[model samples]
Target chain A: MCAQKRAKSDVGEGSPARADLDRTRAVLEGPEIGRALTRIAHEVLERTKGGEGVTLLGIPTRGVPLARRLAERIERVEDRSVPWGSLDITMYRDDLRLAPARALGRTDIPAEGIDDRVVVLVDDVLFSGRTVRAALDALNDLGRPRAVQLATLVDRGHRQLPIRADYVGKNLPTSLRESVTVLLDEFDSRDAVLVGPAKARPAPEEEH
Target chain B: MRHLLSAGDLSRDEAILVLDTAKELAQVSGRSVKKYPTLRGRTVVNLFYEDSTRTRTSFELAAKRLSADVINFSAKGSSVSKGESLKDTALTLQAMGADGVVIRHSASGAAHRLAGWVDGAVLNAGDGTHEHPTQALLDVFTMRERLGHLEGLRVAIVGDILHSRVARSNVLLLHTLGAEVTLVAPPTLLPVSVHTWPCAVSYELDEVLPKSDVVMMLRVQAERMKDAFFPTAREYSRRYGLDRERFARMQRDAIVMHPGPMVRGMEISAEVADSPRSTVTEQVTNGLSVRMAVLYLLLGGSESGIGNQEGQA
Candidate 1:
């Protein structure tokens, strides 16, 4: 995933980059990330019965590249093309009022609507499952899919919702203070997954 | 980017970001599914103190396309009709948890005023003669669509400048995007401080036409005219209106634009308005995508999440 620029002024206590440098550590490097995706692709094919009528919808940012890579793998194995698109869940998130306003990303749905087709949502990391819940709500508005499944590079277990990924590259149990950051070649010009302590920052009003 | 009250508030990068986002969102319109779930649970209020069809509808549609729940509060039907103050109305929207307020008011700087009163993001639809930032964005979006770029391109804004919020906003925004703007209007219609703006002033429309890559025609507000800005409608048409003759003189690739509600004979002839070079219709369509982009950026999407992070920080 591309490194989202967290504003320096907005970082509550210490320098965000400095804090990242000190506390964050890589859990999976480039080669490991590639292997995980390959295994997930095979699992997806096995689950969906050779990937027929399956459409890959990547959640924006890292998920998009992950979805594309999965589709490429599915094509090479199954020998059939799988349609892919990007799903932006900004509007459907439940915590919109609780959090600051976010920028909307592109929602590029394939020309063939999701109706009666299997949809596999791809993402870099599955944390909290809030994004998945929002993605489900977003997908419902587009069309009724035959089945909706999720494939993630990492599942840092602390799901606040009743959502689970059918295909998980790694299941890393993490605490509330820890965050899993994903890096993809398509965005960060490298592939890796990092686990770091998420500092308890002050609330927006409390910040300078 | 938080509160788009004026075109002057935008830097070149911020303006380009909106345009780029609009370009990406424009693709959604062609898809099998026209809606996106970016703002599904968010509330967007369209608060209009002035009567406007195009802008209000465009914003409403833009919000709807992004799956935002829109509540259109017009002055004639709303509590404002009962003399409720802007502050009271803002407080009410705040109480109801509106995530964004797209406001159009008759008074200049009304949106800016509303911004200070509301906690949610405030988008200025058109605040009197001060600015209509989205309209300018859409115009720039259309210009870039036609010409492929705005840098160093010549744009002639023709007709009323004094009472035109469109002209004012366009000058500010186009200038920021690296385009050279020339305001072509009768001296009486030009603002007194026109020289202070980052543009050239021109009295001859014909001279500016051949050199301009884009010609934007402003709507002459007949109702707002208390004094004679021009001798007669016929005289204005003959002198400043973009008729077939002037249209022919423009570069063959030159695009004609009008922030609509056009007085066909007074500011633009029917022939030219309907001509192939005119982007009046496209502007309306582009308005939806442009508004969508602004709302998306301000509200926070994953790709452009830079907006809301500041709120928490």
Candidate 2:
């Protein structure tokens, strides 16, 4: 809790730490996440057949939010709570050196190891396949799983890695020179992915 | 629909078309019915791996106004809390049937990954310290709204250019429209090779203040302080903050701009932010219009009807 507090501001109105928030927003007043979750939860139920032995592991931050929603949906649908856990794979990343050293998000292991359990990895974007690989390694450290599945909202194509998404809300075939971004109402008070031309940002030291 | 991914994907003509289209979308916002039947029966999902409100709201409102069903999936409280992978979460959204998605992630290319996996249109809100195209578009829209044209306007982008995606996109868009861009920040806050850009560079905001027709300020993230990005926030504020003194030093008619939630006592002063000369609110208002334009054109509307070669639609 103390560590999380250090990385993220204590939530409140008009906090000085709000400066850390890059953009201002009317976040809580904007829209709903529950409906989307309920819809996703229904999809997961359809795929897994009543959520009898399904497990959901949300990636830290936003992934956890979606996982909780799906879990609630699963519980509501099947009258059973499949195991839910929040995993933080910051230490497991391959490109940690590319940027600043970040404060770790957190990793909570389910009491049950994923061995033989249908494990679904959840994160906000399916880029590079590196985070999923890191999650796999972290999951290996935790326990064996029966199967691992993937899900995302948008698929902006141009993969450097061979990874593919199984379930996608939208398929956006794009160029290597383009970028697709998703913004949510919780962290971001608006909900829409934007497509724009990619402009290479020179590293700071590369400025004219 | 395709991803509104990068400026490189667009020719100069395509870029102006988006601006021109946004002008038409602006009309829709003022209507008694802000809703359009253009994107009816379509589902737009916002999937932010990063934290943002302004860009998200712009896209959300844009989609809603277009009559598309909107779904928001933030990475803060659900499966993200339990460590579900990005691939998994994306697949979940796909199964749920999302037609288009707007994404914002801290990693520079997280949006690229999402674009590859899903079967819908993708839009890049922002990815890391990379690019915020709509912010740049709305900013330029605000400028053009006031100045009548972007050609030959002397625009100065001040403050932390090093970590500003807004600066990157603005430089590209502004230069594309024939504006003379001067990036002002400390030596520590600039990119390594700025001359490659069609813009000028300066270490002092005051030196260039008088000549600039438009002055855009970027937020200074104190978190960058963890890496010694600058000596002190006080030193930075002293050097770069658009306080009453420095703001007074600017061209009298020149407007001040920020992609806000401003840090009250930090990068910009309350007086300047609240001043009649400030275009911040206008930027927000224009963001929805700019985003609506993006959704419209990229969603398959004719570009010729939206904007000309340079916003003379």
Q: Write the per-residue lDDT of candidate 1 for residues B52-71, one digit (tens) a residue.
A: 99999999999999889999
Q: Write the per-residue lDDT of candidate 2 for residues B1-313, one digit (tens) a residue.
A: 3566654455566666666656655755433345655566678899987777888877998898877889988999879879998888888888988877788887787767777788766778988888777788888889988888889999999988888888988998888888899999999888887778778999987898889999998888655445777787888888888999988888888999998878877889898899999998999999998887777555433221222122111
Candidate 2 deviant stretches above 4 angstroms: A1-208, B300-313
* CAPRI quality of model 2: incorrect
lDDT at position B206, candidate 2: 85
Where in model 1 is the C-alpha error above 4 Å? A1-25, A201-208, B1-3, B20-49, B62-106, B110-123, B292-313
What is candidate 1's local distance difference test score? Answer: 0.81
The lDDT per prediction is: 0.81, 0.69
DockQ of 1: 0.23
